[model samples]
Target: MPRFFKQPFFAWFSPSPSRLQRRQLRQAIAHIIGDQPSNLDVYQLAVRHTSAAKETKIKGFRESNERLEYLGDAVLGMVIAEYLFKKYPFKDEGFLTEIRSRIVNRESLNGISRKIGLDHLIEYDGQRGRLMPARTSMYGDALEALVGAVYLDKGFNFTRRFILKNLLSHYDLDSIISNNTNFKSRLIEWAQREGKELRFEIISENGSSQYREFIAQLLVNDEPFATGSGYSKKKAEQSAAEKAFEKLELQ
Candidate 1:
């Protein structure tokens, strides 16, 4: 057995009272996933954020959900791509790609994770004074880690079923397809159709290097149509475009 699996802290036969907590955690995870996990430690690690991680002697590096997140990201993309290909056989690649992006975006994933109650189960070091404010993306990252754990414990097919039955079932695909919110693209298309110039300008930047805020302005024919702020230039532009799209009734 691996050192981590042999550790008394995770040993299934440990006589410590923590054994009860571990059992309870396993049950909770089984309930959430609708299937029993063979390697409970992997799932436990999935919910653990880097802020609460501890270094291991074997790896000399902290163990957290990041690695699982990367794996799950690729798995999720593949599953989603396969699903879109099957669902929309006639749809062009651009449409499929755009829809996939919208579905897998950070905000969408965060919302889905929250809806599935994954946010409540996440373990992070919130008490650390130096830790940055909890980001919504953490919940999404944890959710991805959970997917990776599921894939490892169960398999790819089971992971796909979990995503389709538990996660995607909660979303209305018809509504999502009908109500595309690529405001920036829509605004640009509208501008091109009307033979008007459209541009985005970064008006200001503020905050620390780690968490800088950007303000963006959307201009139509050199006239400012709307202004918005976000954590990144792309986000700010998207917000500005959204506001402009709504105000101008472009859609």
Candidate 2:
């Protein structure tokens, strides 16, 4: 079956431009991509999306990022899975899977995208009410698309090396494994040691379409110790824990 057939209905509604008309776009992309892609079509399709592209004159003439995102997602998962499996040969499948999940998850991908400055390179039209300026989801998607681009531009070897160097290398495997840590667990340990009741209750969790904000309160022995907010519940809890730890001088 054709890939287009597999795409959602909204995809076909947005018209993608002809190859000739996309020459200028390809040039713009070349500037951003830094190297001429071996396959410009893939790169162009990655940037096009129903939400981002719009047409005033023609009834339909736009691009969509959905397909690229889909392809990128598969590529990323495969590469990460292989890397983890090979790197941690002694570890069981479950251990390797967890680490891979953590490494390629939304938060981690967003962080890597920011570090490599992919956020700035993204191009989108202003037709949508307001693009999420949060930089996490967009950048994360872009990171995946970038992996797809790299795979097409160079090959699996190049893409694999890039992922390892840029994203995976930053992670301290030793520290991560030894710590096996997260804020909620750490807080629990502290509370147990201090003989205090640690509690995290959701306060206000709301946000616009671009982002979701979570507010959480930390209580120690029924006493509110700290308040924290973040894009995710876990992150919010972590922030609250840090604040509580600081207040208790347990840092």
Candidate 3:
């Protein structure tokens, strides 16, 4: 069993887990992550959704998994890129890129996060409609945040191993390769075919240079249709396109 009440942030601001709750949280973290965490507070923050930022709000600063999500997004991209690069030594750049996108894309991660039961552990505001949409990305974002937490607590090498063992195992690389999901291209083509204007606008960009985050809104005939977020402009657009494509029922 892992130690409890290990960090001040969690003990003070966030929901104060009881002795039993702390024990349960520690056990849950170990069980879900397959390793005990050194800092319990960070892990708690990882599952914290943006809507509940105010609840765990620090007096002088903002608190949410958003920053960690950005870090994890970058980490995930790099680690997965390296994995695909080495795994497909003979494959072309486009092939590897597409496969990697398929793996890290919002939809794929959402499914994986839900399947892994990360949704249940997330501390979010259910009352907030947009924050908890019907088909929510909250769980997926939490997963990325959780990855960030792992990276912070255990470092890169351990995080890499954890991803390979826990996350990549849920995926079939061959199947991902077989599927052709170029949402951006498809959406552009649809716009051209239907004679409708399509644009992906970067509405916001925030965070430090190391882990900058992008939020994109998809426009159809100059109207906002869907929005998505990622660590890069291209990634944000890709995420936006995916959401728009699904919204349009193009699939």
Candidate 4:
């Protein structure tokens, strides 16, 4: 548990941060999200990773960013879908969906998080590293959680603007569309051509009942090659394949 949860007096409640610390965090978040928030708790919760999380005594829920991540995923996807629909007026649904997927994927969001310095602000158990494994989407998950906080704090219009101006502005849609490659399909082709035994299997599933997590591991020559996770098997497979694609250097 983090020191913030350790109050000499009321151990059940989180202690208030120092005035200077509060100001610094508020400024940092304002720089990222483009607004000074009225409610700091929501944004603070956005960056708290599960490894450092504390469960509520009554609710039986940890004070982590998972719920916010879920909400933000939907909000971010919808905004991206709407933007693509308008920008590519004559594009087919397939094209729109593919482009949107490329933009909103975990790796893509993680890269953006690094670019925008959001990775620096996330609070997790760094020593034990309980939340980080290879190719973990912690950075992007924090970003999604931040988006959820923005939505809750400032409402949809502000959140949409923040997504467009702060997030999407960092992307080049035309370049992304042209350079897009589906790792799972490419990996499948590589295996077929090289006569290498390749497969993907779901190793685990755990999350809220509304959105179950699927962890998929890629196997090559009957050995585990790489693993990835998502809300669905197909996405988990895709994520695992992406990691495998990088390691295998498949074209």
Candidate 5:
């Protein structure tokens, strides 16, 4: 069992964790992550979704997992890159990058987070009165936040061990490497081989500046082939290219 407020910095927060909440949270963290968390508040914050974030006095903006997610994104990428480097000492940069992308992509992380039961631990605002489906990225985002929490609580080496020994160990690396998809590259290659001109043009943009959505259309031989939408121009192009690839079924 991990002791709460064990650090001097945590003591400054003036936390008062109920016995039951502390026990339950500690046990849950231990079970899910296979380690004790030094800072309970950080873990709690990590599991808190933006929808459920509350306004804080320090700043007008509410506290959410977004910052932690950003930190974890960088941390996760670095650790995974290191792991892949060591795992395949002779592999080329492109190969390593492809494998890392396959491992860290939104779809893969969402699936992995669900597999590790992070979905059940997330705290979100379900009472917002929306009948639509839940976003798949939420689980993945929480997973990243959790990684941030782990990093904060236990430092880099511990987080690395947790990721490598606990999380990455569960994945089938060989299969991931084999099934790596670079749809944009594939589309470009297909266009070159078929002697067709390929162009990806942004059709529209929406959402706030911080979180923008882009719609891209794939034009083959100056004719529209397929359209796709994503959070960025590159993502949209890749998505459009994926659709085009599927439609063309290039061998």
Candidate 6:
């Protein structure tokens, strides 16, 4: 039996067992993964904490999730790219890129992470009680690290299966196509059908280099439709266009 079964277990003790003790725990993860996870080190690397994880480095190097996060990001991109290619055979490169971006975006990754109880796997010294909702990067990054681990341990086929089973299973193809198409592309398509002129322009810039900001204005038929701001020029344009689209009630 595991030491966790020895009684008087700490509430803060690992939610997932240590690597050596994961035969049973990982079995469930395996079913979730559709394969046995052989790289305990890689898994550990995913959930490890770094000084950058917080403001200080009270723990050692192995504690940080950086290395595993790097690996996981690559693995995730590869699997998602492959999936998009197969799923959208007739789609152009730009169209496929849009869908892939939506699937692997931070929001989607975080959603999937929560489903896997990834928060339970992270070990941190920060005050759990006072932590705000926004400081949950560990959960998102850990998911990516897990992907990296899966790729390194089991190879691409297993990783692809895991992605298809757990993550891609939830997305609707048509919905993704409708929602994730670029604002510019979608707007142009609508305009072409309606025979109207549309334009986008950068309005202003704000903030410093470390945190630059952009404001964009959208024009429909040479009149201002909407304005929005974001961390980048492109994002501002997208936001402005989305607002304009909403205002026009054009899907």
TM-score, one value per model: 0.68, 0.55, 0.69, 0.71, 0.69, 0.61
Regions more than 4 Å wrong, model 1: 1-17, 129-135, 180-251
Residue pairs whose backbone atoms clash in candidate 4 = none
lDDT score for candidate 2 against the true structure: 0.67
Best by TM-score: 4
lDDT tens per residue, model 4, 34-140: 77888988888888777768678868777889999999999999999999999999999999998998899887888788777776667766565655432578888
Better of 3 and 6 by lDDT: 3
lDDT of each: 0.80, 0.67, 0.80, 0.82, 0.78, 0.69
Name the runs in model 4 displaced over 4 angstroms.
1-16, 131-134, 180-219, 222-251
- Model 4 residue 72 CA deviation (Å) reads 0.6
lDDT of 6 by residue, 1-251 (tens): 12233332222225445555555446535655676677665665566555324333555323457777888888888888988898779989987777787777666676677676555555554543453334445567778878877888888887888888876787676786766546768888888999989888998999889999999998889999899898999899988977776666454
Could you tell me the C-alpha RMSD of candidate 6 in Å?
9.9
lDDT of 2 by residue, 1-251 (tens): 11222333223223555665466556655554455667776665565433565554667754456656777788889988888788788999978877776677676677666665555545554356465445326667877887777677778776777777766766776765664446678779977887888889989889886799998899888988899899988788888886775565452
Which of the two, 1 or 6, has more TM-score? 1
By summed lDDT, the worst window of 10 consecutive residues in model 6 runs over: 1-10
The lowest-lDDT stretch of 10 consecutive residues in candidate 3 is 1-10
Q: Which is the leading candidate under lDDT? A: 4
Summing lDDT over every window of 10 consecutive residues in candidate 2, give the lowest-scoring window: 1-10
For 1-251, candidate 3 gives per-residue lDDT tens digits of: 11221332133324555777667677778987888889988888888777777533556576889999999998988899999999989999988887888798777887777767666667766565464333667767989999999999999999999888899999988877776577899889999999999888999999999999999999898899999999999989999998888777564
True-structure RMSD, every candidate: 11.3, 12.5, 9.3, 8.7, 10.6, 9.9
Clashing pairs for predicted structure model 1, backbone only: none
| Count of clashing residue pairs in every prediction | 0, 7, 0, 0, 0, 5
Better of 1 and 6 by lDDT: 1
User: Where's the lowest-lDDT run of ten residues in candidate 4?
Assistant: 4-13
Q: Which stretches of candidate 2 lie over 4 Å from their true place?
A: 1-35, 48-50, 54-62, 178-183, 186-251
Model 5 alpha-carbon drift over 4 Å, by segment: 1-18, 129-134, 180-216, 219-239, 243-251
